[model samples]
Target: MEGKESKTACSEGFSSIRLCVFLLALLALIVLAQLAQAGISRIWAVDDGEKVKRIDNNHPLATSSDNPVRDGSEVSLFGAKNEVSANEDGRFVVLPVENPRYRGNELFRAFENYYSPRVRELRNRYGLDAVVAGETDEWKRILLLRHWIKSSIAIDNENPTKTRGDTFAILDAALREGKFHCTHFSIVQHAVLNSFGYVTRRLGCGPGLKEDGGHHGVNEVWVNKFRKWVLIDAKYDVHFEKNQMPLSALDIRDEIWRDGAQSVVCVVGPDRHPMKPDSETGKSETRPDTYRWCSWETSTNRFTTFPATSTSTLIMLQDEIFKKNTWYRDGKPHWAYGTPYMILTTRRDWIEWTPNVITSKVTIEDTKARVFLSSCTPNFRSFQTKAGDDTWRDCSEEVELPLAKKGRNCFTFRTINLFGVAGPEHRVEIVYSLDKSEPTTPGTLFSESFDDGKLLNRGWYDGDVFNISADEAYLGVGCIEYPWEKGHTKPSGCSGVRHLFEPTEEVYLRCYIKLSPGWGWTNRTYHPHLMHFLTTENGKYHGPAASHLTLYVEPVNGKLRLAATDIQNKNAPHGLTQGPLRGGYNGKLYDSKEVLFDDSKWYCVEAMFKLNSLDVKNKRPNADGQLRGWFDGKLVIERTDIIFRSADFPGMKINQFLLTPYFGSGLLPHSQTLWIDELAVGTKRVGSVSPPDSSAASATSWGLMLERINQHFPFTFNGAADSAIVYANLKELTSP
Candidate 1:
């Protein structure tokens, strides 16, 4: 499974001064070793022995001009603040004489202390296709670098006896031990940006609102383009932003204090906790309320500046670097120039929704609907809208309108960019007039999506197991979260959404899902089933299984694969006692290796289970029962001549649609999460793509922004040889 790698080693303590000296020496040795293998003459990216193909023949990077004279008109286009310029393709170059107020090189060495071999080797293994992971644009490259470094290290809470405050020593010690915490996280980010000639500072977040009582740590970096200091929470791997542009601590405090949640646009990472367990299921899936204790996502009471940022500096520098933007007009540096604060105003655009299904905009005769949100410049980072009286979240791309809310419902959404700039508010009104609706016919059923931030108000219910979540989703707005304990192993970890289906000769169902990366390996049984159905004796809610069918995903030979199963025996239901689950791999498991399932990507999984004749006397009813599966619109698994049920017991109808999308137990080594969307079942086949393609996953302006961002930061190594290496040990994308 593609997940965070757990790696840590106990560290031996050292005095701050001694640790700094030792780490610098070690870095020098590593540099010397590389020079020995290649040479100082070659401006290479890594010590890979092969001569890098330089982008430009004439020394690729721009050399410092001999005269070092400033051009008056050049400042607006070329960045030469503090004697620096965009030398070539967004890379920075410094003039001969360093600015008296800057300590760029000194900070560079500090970054070297933490850029260990493990970092480089990982980049090499992944090869050139890692720029998307690192990025090319200097500012966003920092974001990607921040994400990769943090994602590589899992949280290790074992308190160390002696933790160094010096940025270089702290980062070295953290990397050497492969352990991470709030401080270590900040150090890694600080080191990387610091190495890249960006002035970065470390700080501590207060325990409460008092800066002096800080318990958590964060970092800040000076973005030359935006010409501002941006606040980044390395622990959460997120940064605050407004209007899609990044924001600083003072900016965040002032805007939030002034405008409250409206000033805050969106978080760049998973900065919120999963929803609280709404109801209860008598299973391991019931998470303790303590799960809500996700401190990283919560608002910091106080933002405290770390003393190391000041004391660790190599020279006595002016504090102006933290405040002013450098503007050169008429061949002179203008340090006092101010840029107007950017804010989004009112937006004028309309959205489209499906009329056939339930939508916030229209009263639907059907169970589902899709809506389209307006676009933005740097593009929509997320949305902030109400669900319940108070439920609001930074929603992603597609939002499923709440059908349960009758009449007209209003929702305000805005577009956000990486710079933390949020665009104008686009208020949308969903009109659901229940009076004007079409009647339903036979061979039809309903669908449910928590996109509206409400539970199923229709026939389906949580059955006391799942909680509605806004953080994760495959499509539309929301999906019910299948929460479970940290280390409990029981079949109870399954999703709690339940619906007793009326009997039909054949029922076809399909749902989009984003699987947990740690699912397959964390599950003891190599195979794990998610959606299962059985015949309820009372035809209501109770778990009575005379027959059953299931669809799930699993790992086969290290690659994720889709699979299915069934227990068609009599009332005993193939010796069923263990919560309606029959023999493991009862028949030939249904799966296709040609199209492996990806945990990180969304897939439309569907299954068609047809019932056998009730008159069949034999246990293995051959002719009538059948099963077929489709993945992402492609047919993968099929079984004809199967016994899904028997005659004597006569519970032929498929009753309970157990909304369980989970592994066997809750005792998982790693906590994982997934999302299910567009879940529906009817007598006819429902392929991955509906007629006219009702997919909300179509590309958008935000998608375009991310595309350009990825292009500039392609997930591949672009041989843009930096003078030396910074920690390249990066993110583990998707499954192996």
Candidate 2:
């Protein structure tokens, strides 16, 4: 009876075990199915066009759009209701319209600091490209760079050099002390990767347990091969990998949690050899415990000026199962752990964002679609676009594509780096309709010819010292004049005119001016402030010399200049980036390469000033503002990237115009008379005055001006390397 019962019990146990195994297999399938669906969704969200959906919720992704959809979200495309979707190939996708409720809140700017001129100079000066030139594999190149830095600088934690994140200074110190800390290693590594066109961020790691004390600084670089961020510990010349795939900080932590560090492989040196146990410690170089917690610096470019700690930091923690409040002592946050000012996010996507990605916006009007592309690509070269079956064509960031058909219009965009590497393609589709209104033109805000010989009647103020003379005029018989006595700086008592209008984001001023024969230049860097614009943030009668925001359009040392002085903003939080606080003046100067002004000849001068966009939600300023100058219908000075104001003045506008020409106190060279005629201001270009008679003297004057320009500044004209080409073009345009 006992044998029979035992056999029966054994059989029942086997049956139960089989059932459990079956259930486990079924659960695994379900999980795999869900993961597959998620993967498909991610691809659709970024790559494919068919599954693209409007982000209606207040998710972080919504911040990428200027207009985010909210409650009762509905998007209209080509007079149709929200019925946009991509075709089967996913080659084209429809983008949502602008969301009015969405404020300008962006995780990253259109231009990242990795591509700044400073970084480019650093790369060239250090020959960073040649460091990895021989390496064919991208991963090998990264490893090679790590090894190079480690071999060059020795580790010295006890007395690390205090170079404060300056790569150049750190390298210079490396030659003397020959040692530094992990922070220095990571700083140099981060900058080197950026110089090579790889986006990177400094990572700070610490132990999770309170009893465990110590910290380590490393770097996480974006590797296009794996399409993910990989951890590179330059201090120890090591990296973590699993199944031949490089691992990130979070990856290492998760691997330790799953089983042990047995599966995690430690890769060391450019040769990609397995790391050996430390001679003294008898432990692996990569301590998994050290990566229990991780944080990244917010700005990658701030390392040159100061340590990453000076800028905002972002703490990234795992999911709830691993997260612990005990990480903060007494449940009180710490800067090293986490603080109120520091952003703490459980989402890994926020920390491991894709680099060198193209962001696009599409606007459809009439039979045309305007696609505006912006990117944070390092070493960005140009944007390439393809329409329908057309081959890819290199185009500007903003392009207008024609919609030949009424149905599906597909467009694909990608950004190319300086190294010829192309970013992931962003495909978009739009449905077009021929029924649309024509684009409207901007209207004139204010115009003055002085031909009326009156000021008060034409919306002019502060013109007490103004005199309308007929001595010389570009078009009309009357012109405004200001006379100076010999050795007298302001004998006319600051003679000028002011015009006030409704607040405007942009304004264009056009006028014809002629200086007295043998007119003299200030010869100093600054002075002879000619035309100026004051923002609405300041009083209408505010002096342009020192005000909240004063944009100066004048001649400095005979060169056309577009400058800004915001002495009032000297103490603002963002003052440092704008200009320096020298004594009581703070401003930035943008001068033309060629001197566009000459004496005793009427010249057409026009200037356009546009305010930069502000990320109001984040209180950040964009550097897309423009200041353009035209000399006799030819573009002389063009500055598209400028920061005119900070977020503190969100409502600022160019409301007041000043035509005050003054040489700084006692700085006027000599007595000279300046005359202006046919002055006009409007929301659009006011057009230029016709050239004077095409006579031999007129041609000679033009030739002399060109010669003087070349003599004063011989290198290039507005960054163009071929100055001869520029002169040739100018000669063709100005030929009699």
Candidate 3:
């Protein structure tokens, strides 16, 4: 059915491609000096180094036939050597002997072929070389170099493959792949500059460990014109859009010298600890000490050692492993959390798989108790659980499915326990066989049907239908009457679970939504209560009415925008009575921009509300005021701060929240409703919202995020919080 809509949303927008755009922009702004022969280029001597006077005769630096190349002067400092090659032209590029290999390094080849080509093209087109000429020669070079590197590569922690010996291979793969770690970029860029006859070396440092323990590396280039090593970080260029420093920005106190390539830092020795397990149980009388390799700051070139154990993610891997069990069993893992521990824990939903159902017998077992659990409607072949308890017992009831209409079957833990101790306990398994002969559906739908009872078979379908998606729990129903349409007054008729959020802290309710076909609307006399399931009893005291955040779903700029106000605060202005409006603490909308929403795509929408206003430091919020939103991944509105109290600007606190379908007039209806997943509410302000991970997006930028978050540390050690000390230290410097 056609529905009335607002004016179409404006399309003028600027999308952000962090890694790609940054790299391109950086490349465009580089200033490579092109000095003609005989030009007098300025070369400065270091505090402790000697300078040489050369004859500047007009000629091409590359093809100066008359000038004899002489070893005029050299300076050594740190662990690198800086040498300026007097090109035919008086101007020169710095050549720092960085590693064992001279000039031609693996990284050098990748840059010349892949990165430099694009950079040269961009530089020529932008004319940036001219814009940066007179800007404090040192400052200009630094700025240019910083921009080039920051935008060129995306930073990552772990490389896909295990290879790590050569920087060039790593950089080449990363640049080609559009993502890499800082170390990889440094290696590659060093090699490329070397190939260009420019000297390059590694200036590595770490956190005040030994010289090598610092674990930091940046490239140094010696420009004959400058007579010093211009420090540049190829890694920073590869991973970021804003380089931290420039080439001419010198911070070294002493002269710098380059050494053949060596590890930035490596801890050679091992530390041993007494072998003490939480439980003391060993058959042998002689118990050996346990030793785990940890990073250290040693005196060698490799100072700050980063243990492989600390860098890889074990959590995500464990999560993948957990999903395998689910897919292998009931077609999905029944994931939930335990209270206290579970309530405070973060939830990670795994990628959903297409289902292929085959004939199978179900089994139940409690691994913790080492016993098989009982079922309610269990058939030797098929059934679901409805009872609560111990022992491996199949339900007395038996059921069967038609050979046709075999969809992936899933189970929900209703009366089952996750811990196998208290509450309801149950563990179920299915056994079936896969049939490759069957064709798969081309959408997120059921794929195959297994008729055997040996191994569980699973397959998937793909489609664009938003009704069924990878992130949904497929609930099936036979030819029963539409429960809501049949006027079923039971709470279960609404089906959707009511989640009551009691303020561990105050929260804001924001979401992107669409309604089901024929979903009813509300009139003045009738309004549906926003249900809050606060108790596990299912039939216990329902939360009080009027405490929920009142919401009305309506069309705003051709998209569904949920307009909510601070209804919990009784002191604010009342809301408009008609056209999808509800009462709450109203604030001025002096300037309201259009809201963006995707037709079928998921939009990342966020809302933040102040929880208090009375206490200055930690005051109770008057109303949730700051209302902002995004569509796809672009910010659409910067709503005027929702001021609750007229006296204090933008004064308001938030309480109670809700998400429900429209209860107003049904005249302006939507053709297809929306499905929502990944709903988050926070009291803290959300700055940039990341788009959902999809294959269509560039994976290189993922490297940048990986480098920043260092998610690897948490995932590697399971429950051990100490796996990521490096990340922990790094995060401290940039903590918000």
Candidate 4:
């Protein structure tokens, strides 16, 4: 066991003597800078053997071909002659970034691209470019750049602060304000690292194992030394290491969840110990049988990061990465559109080839503009356009499909035309249903066969959505579903599992749900609690619940959505106490803004909740917990900061897995019923057992990282799957 730990956890190269010396030198510089802390805002400079060059307004370096490119004459800091080609300001795009975000090396291209002159100017005044230029080790260069970013961009907590336009404009804002936030800090680091030809990406971080799970911004540099991406949190002036090896955002997420928080520690922070771990269910709770819904949203709640997709997300995206939102898994949606050059659209659910299913004709269509519809997969295969609304001619010659796996198949095609206009690559996900004729194994987590006609009482309990019927079953004689009746208004029933007999850190729940022919027939409205997590006192039923988060099937803004939200704190008064409506913390609405769920289709809905521990620093009410859900293995909604309690409320815990299908105060558009079968709750990944690739969702670079993590990490590795299916380009995570 110790040997295994050495191979995976403890073997990262943080203990190298070279890095040790460099860190010591950097530490001394940090101390000296601290002594001159008063000038931190006014002048952020670095020693270049002879003088410290301040990057304030007094020292100006311009890159405008439209005007003079310099106010002061350039000086040789590193003794290397510097050359920069000037270009128009706003047209500069950083990175020309490749997909599989964390590992891409856009730095060289970005530094040499049109943005080079402006970037070089910024680098010269700051003086770190010379230091970075002198370093041969990518790792050391990253550290040097990290120190400058931390030293230069002071954290701005004041709200009156404002932002300018575009990436260059934001850099101007940062220079002017002198003070910055975590967002600006990463932006500066990204530009500086790229300037020195070190591939860099802005990575988003969520709460620690404790705390309110605030959104934090960190940067990852593709280090040649490690041959992999490593994290740098300039805000803390530290990086994360496990067994002394640097970590990526994914690594941090894995370590925090898989094995608890023991091996995870900060590289250079006052709190270098493990951030904390998933806390147990709080004591002093009530019976969940009496629990009802509570509404909450925090007006003053601010700390953690929000996804770039959300309108409420607060971050300055002046850099190209921000403008493009490439920090998260982003480009998977275009796969359905065939190829950009093809410009195809479809009414059929992406290429289905499963058992007992007919190859019905699926409508395929295309429009001029690639809305780049957000999907678990890509929207188009390949793409390029000469002029808007003119002609989007197909140039992708085409590629042949690969052999299909026994269970599922996937295909992709990419092309770059002679004009250098690249096409959006096509990614295909097709599931060849597992052989039902052969013996089917149970999912990695718990599996239920309703043939016995009752929920196993030991770990599972009966709740609101519990009605056994042999009418239609996935396998056994019985499948659970809402009582089907004419004009059913408030149909609600449920069954739940207490706590896993083994681990409690993270749990993935999977179940087979089939809408009755009545699924959405009422066509009026559908608010079905496909499932809900209830906080229990002792893993058993606790009542008058203080916390609960739920997942329901409802039509939101004309789209059928699988939404997730929990009970909000009533006393927090974040935005709740307006008048008669007394609000507490706000519940995050898990809407991916995509409508993929349809009725009458046998769908597998899976959810994983990594219960976040309560931290002393971020006390009461405010919570940034994680709740992820997938339909047919296609990610539909994700919520990282889901509030379930208030300052006085207890820690957020999901005790009861309630399959509550109900409409609170209104009736269904018409009488309608919902059906369910084969429910499961376990510590392992409980994914789709049939058609639609469970593994298909994970078959990418992100999937590779999750696989490597499961093997490279110790036995404490939390869940087998790194995350529920996410539709974006970069990998999405739910961490401590």
Candidate 5:
């Protein structure tokens, strides 16, 4: 629901001229540089914590007299490469030199210092309070801060008439005009957060391994509970969609920090120089004569450069925050420098998994365990990590979360049962872990249901997080309810009466299926349909129904293919498939291959449509020339022509589709599976797919220019303004 608003008209095309120009400029600049090398050189630190007194009296590392000196000796810091001086007061002094080589460090520092007083003043005048309220949790607070920063700063549209000045003036103009660059966005965000008493600092920017070669910006904030600074990328937020992620989440972080975390960096065209060389540091890479510290984060940062939404930007932002301190730092951590290469390193720290205080009483009976425990908090972003694997999976929930105990609220463990307790006299074991990763196919941790006696809703015991349901369940990119609730429609465009249910010990192999025989207008009856069942256990795929259970049903085929064989328990990690399925069968109603339906009497159906020939192009008509309709043991209709086919995703090739309608239950008295015979299969694929009829004459296929102009206005007037009407009548360029 939140991601639906992000759909926008796709842009037409790209410009090769612009790309060529950018590449040429970058090549020229890199060629101009005297040093062309790779790998880490030496690291130099300028730790301000160990304050320096003064700079060397005689110019040694210093190239300018304007450089600040303290204690008559120089010092080094973590990020900045410039020489530092210690004053007589036992405090280190580093003069803000002009045109520094690595502009990111100085710009970040200037941004913080220059705007601190202004930020304070604005807060007092507007009573906006902290950008993020203290009462909010760390993740929420960070999210709020991100939203404020991203929404407030506008992209800088450089006007031909305006003269560029200092970062402050430029940022102010951009903010006033509702336009800002990347650095401007970062600077504003940092200053604003600092004013709110947030521990914030800027990361480095420069060329990256990605296609784009422009200035990048990353930052950090101290998470209270973690008591550590987390990395952030303000530019990524501005560039990409803050809602729907277009690129990989971690890729955005690598663009800013460039520690091999991301594979690519999305950036706008044209190369920009790094910080100008300070008169002090004699190290000159790119000459200062042609370079200017243009805050380009506005149009060409990782997030903004990509065609993404605000939520996607938020996902990337979260990833960036976590990427910091992923690795350890060695020696005097050299401050990252250079135009496009800002080296970043960190030490990995241990993460804690605080267990839920509410104890769950799980009855482990016959290898089956049922636990009803409500976790105090449902950390929305904090997910479960499966044992043995370095990935995180999704879980179902009932309420809004990020579950840490809230005030006056008690957690009630909602009971959602799981079946199939295998392994004779087994011992139940469950562990919990949490981390971050891409969200993928998520399932539960059970084997089979006793009532259905068929495996439908199976789960896995991944030692990390389990897919515990508070209420909702997974359905594609969104979630759906178990039973069809009022107004709860099936996935859009899905045909037939879809009865999706979670089978339990009481309702095993039970469904409402019926059929009608003799084609054409049957006067009183209709065609036939069937329901199939498939089974899975522990998040992995097992063979067809492995249990030898008795079934009772009205005969459809010869005698219902009631008994099954070749049932096996598969434990291979890759073969497991989880979902609404029980067993497999040949549910054929079309073609001259299978004669499943016999008498005209009503009968139950259960079978799997082995999706073999899904070729959209090979659509051929049957004998009657009425589009193929395999139902009630007959090919009722077939068509000679098809509307359209998707050229992009051609691999809809299915493996083995199955179905088996059943009767009679293992424990429940009312449970009964009916005869399964005329199982039908056609060209339709499960889940959402393009319409089968996308012909040129179709309304959807027609090009529509739903264009609008100035749809809303503050004022309405005819002709000209009242005051300007008189002047317009006499004015004709004064005819001079």
Candidate 6:
């Protein structure tokens, strides 16, 4: 009996061990399932107050790649690899591509007008900034400005000012006559909003085609806070809203059409109280039915070139029935056809477009995600980025964010304007895995150090007035020198060299140079042409001043300057967007604000030139070309919006480089000699050079001398801090 009992105990113990092992395996499976679920790619948009909404993968704003093929070492989130499927996992992702409907459209190019002198004058003349100084919220400022305009100018539709779109003229007439029309109020409000760096458009609204002369004019301002347009009727001191969010004209029209205008609320006055029928007049301040038909100008730059209308008018119809009828007996609606040209379309995007919204393209390489951001923000300041739960940090237009290897990673990007207003947020999320492929580095197209003391040996051509010298070199024992006679003013005294390479859309040039003591500038705007890039559309020996496209990099009056001229394209069908043709030479000049070069010391100067993208299908040229210059490792000048070519030269590229130094006829201030060395060019940025100790005599000697002085006379100085400051200021003034 004892033997039988012991055997039973052993059998029970074995059963209990088996149960423990099964439980451990089940728990492991559950944890693995949870991790796999968390790794699934998901996108979310976090708005103000941390409101998060999950966006579906099939949403118009979301784009994904199920089997992302590698482009070099990086995987693009769009293009041929873009495919969406529920079964496919481990995909690369990016969010909403910039709406192509507004990409390069001219009607959307209103940001440039904010820099107009007229806009600035209007802001200062009326104390517009002071009026909204206490308001931190951008929407509140918009309401405040509207109230100011409504209170300052009374309404009188009978004797409206004849100075239609001019803000100053309208205000002058209102001050004298004490009243103006609704059109004048909208014009004034549009100008004021633009002066404060807000994008606004004037709209003319009526009940429909049947409404004859009872049309009203109002303004629709882009509120970046909500990432939508809000209609404000300054003349009536009212704006439409639904659910606490401001409604655009189209929104109000849609709401009224679908639900009988019961949901739409009309808010009036600066206090934002609900609209009620006047106690004496027995009429509401604003009616929602007025937005049944809307018309607007294509361009918001009416105040930019006052008294000269350059934009077409577009009218939006509610349905096809309205399209067939005419508002006027002559079949030409005066309100819609007021401009030189007009178009009627039922497309809502053409009438109501959103601006100041951030759009991005993303790529994944290993554990890093690169985000390229673009926007139409006015009065642009800087871009801000947030990674996961991290704090928002200011970043450049192009930023690289890190991704977690084991789980989900998210990033958000937005634009901040100069007035401290933040635009809509663009978010991207991805599940990362390691990519073992090696990244490729850009190869050098051409390099020259003059260390071999030979210029004719390389692929250099047209070498003249330049010879290799062994004295005062920046990098090696040899450098190229150019000597100008004391009183010489002829082109023969200039030095030049040309190098041709494979055509490329972008190029960077870096060189170390030193000007002679007391080197003077050609005080006039033109001349002393230094370095130039010529496109393949021009002949190898074509003059840089006139070509299909010629980019100039030079120092003008001690300031680094980057300029472009396309005289060969001046007569193209598109017309010259950069010039007015001055004596067979015309171009736009971008000068650096700081004096970068003033002393006889070796300085490293680098310039980057990138051609703008072209929309061949639409036959339009985008004004997004870039030109940047750096002096001694510090960026001093940058111009992102430049028109380097027209559609006529769609295949243009930088094929030839010229290092010519010449002053225009009788423009050379004095005979000056300069030295050039370590010239390098590449498709990617050929960064600044670091000189050896022996070559960095000026900077090294000054720093050492200051340190010794501080060491000996410690009481006379504030220790290392004061000595460092003096050393830095003196270095900047005496050297590069």
* Model number with the top lDDT: 6
Q: What's model 5's lDDT at 587? A: 19
**lDDT tens digits by residue: candidate 5, 1-736:** 5344323211222244444444444432432231112111111122322322224335432333333332212211222222222111111111111110110121111123323345456456434466545645544555566665555555442422142423345445655654655555555556545554454544433332233233444555433333234444444342221122222222243333444323332321111112333343211211111111111121212221122221111111112233332221222221223224332211111011111112232332322234333322211122221223533333233222221111111122221111110101101122111111111112211111111111223221111211221111111111111111123222122121212224221112211122211111111211111232232221123223441111112233332322212122123222211111245421112232343443223332322222122234654211221123223333333333321112221332222223322222221112111222112222231111121131222211111111111111111112212213322211211111
Q: For each candidate, how many residue pairs have backbone atoms clashing (under 3 Å)?
A: 46, 2, 86, 68, 111, 0
Candidate 1 lDDT, 252-343, residue by residue in tens: 54453344535454354433222222343211111111111011111111111233232221111111221222223224432222322211
Q: Give all TM-scores, in the order shown.
A: 0.38, 0.39, 0.24, 0.30, 0.21, 0.45
* Local distance difference test, each candidate: 0.42, 0.64, 0.28, 0.40, 0.27, 0.66
Poorest 10 consecutive residues by lDDT, candidate 6: 705-714
| Candidate 4 least-lDDT 10 residues | 289-298
Q: Which candidate tops TM-score? A: 6
| Predicted candidate 3 versus true structure: per-residue lDDT over 408-506, tens digit per residue | 122222121121111122222121112213222222112111122111122111111112232221111000111222233322222232233333233
- The candidate 2 region of ten consecutive residues with least summed lDDT is 705-714
Report the C-alpha lDDT of model 6 over 1-736, residue by residue, as the tens digit: 9778878876776455565444434433443343244332221221222212223444433342432222122211212211211111332322122221122223455543655789778888878888898788888898999988887887766765566557888777677766787888888998898777778888877655443335778989988777778999888778988988899987887776667678888898767889854533213327787776677766677788776767565654434335444544222355445455566543344455556676565667855888788876777788998754677778999988876533345577788877566777766555432222111225567877765444666787886455665444565435777766545654344358899988999999888888765466777776677889998998888888768788898888888888888887777898775688988878899888987885457899989999998889998889899989999988888988877888887898998899887777677655566778888888988776554243232322111111111010011222333334433332332221
Candidate 4 C-alpha lDDT tens digits along 42-96: 2111122222233233433222222222322221111122221111111100011
Regions more than 4 Å wrong, model 6:
1-106, 161-165, 173-177, 209-212, 277-285, 307-312, 315-321, 328-340, 379-381, 387-392, 432-736
As a whole number from 0 to 100, the lDDT of residue 301 in candidate 4 is 11
Candidate 2 residue 380 Cα shift, in angstroms, is: 4.7
lDDT of 3 at 251: 24
RMSD of 3: 38.5
Give the winner by lDDT: 3 or 5: 3
Listed per candidate, the RMSD to the true structure in angstroms reads: 32.4, 32.0, 38.5, 32.8, 37.4, 26.6
Residue 120, candidate 5: C-alpha displacement in angstroms: 2.4
